[model samples]
Target: MNIEWFLVLSALLFTVGLIGVIVRRNPVVILLCLELMLSAGALALLAFSRMLGNQDGQVFVLIVLVVAACEVVVGLGLVVAMYRRRLPLDVDEMKELKG
Candidate 1:
C-alpha cells in the first residue's frame, strides 16, 4: 500500500525486535529478533523503492537480505557450537569467557 504505512509497520516491527533483543536471555530469541529487525529493514527498503519507482532501494533490500541470511547462518552456528561446548544456551549462564 502506501509508503507511510509500510514505513510505520516496519518501525513497529523493528521496535518490537529491538525490545526482544534487549529483554531476552535466550540466544535463539535474540537471533529471532535479529531476523525480525532485518525483515523490517527490507520491508522499508522495498516500500521506498516502490514509492520512488527506483531500483536502488530494491538492490539495497537484496543486499540486506543476503547479509541477513549470512548473519543467520553464522549466528546459529555459533549458538549450536556454544550449546555443545557450554552445555547451556542461557546468556546469563555463559561464564566461560569471563575469566
Candidate 2:
C-alpha cells in the first residue's frame, strides 16, 4: 500500500529491462527489453500519480502507452523487413543502417 513498494518494483523492472537490453544481441529481444523499460516507467508514473492523487500521471501513462505501441509497430516492421531480406538479426552486425 506504500509508494515506496511501488517505486521499488518499478526500479526492479527497469533494472531487469536495462540488463536485458545490454546483454542481448537479437533485435527482437532488444525491442522487448525496450518495451519492458517503458512499462517500468509507466508503472512508476502511475504509482506517483496515485500517491499525489491526480489525473496527470494517468494521462501521461496513456501517452506513453501510445508511443510504446507506435515504437513496437515500427520496430517490428523493421525486423520483418530485415528478416525478409535475409539479413543478420544480431544488433552488433547491423552496420548497414549506420548511414
**Scored by Cα lDDT, where does model 2 land?**
0.96
- The residue-by-residue lDDT of candidate 1 on 12-60, one tens digit each, is 9999999999999998999999999999989988998899899999999
Model-by-model lDDT, in order? 0.91, 0.96
Candidate 2 off by > 4 Å: none
Residues 1-99, model 2: lDDT tens digits: 999999999999999999999999998999999999999999999999999999999999999999999999999999999999999999999887997
Clash count of each predicted structure? 0, 0
Model 1, position 22: C-alpha lDDT score: 97
Candidate 1: count the clashes: 0
Best-matching candidate per TM-score: 2
How well does candidate 2 score on lDDT at residue 5? 94
Please give the RMSD to the true structure for each candidate, in Å.
1.5, 0.6
Which stretch of 10 consecutive residues in model 2 shows the poorest summed lDDT? 90-99
Which number leads on lDDT? 2
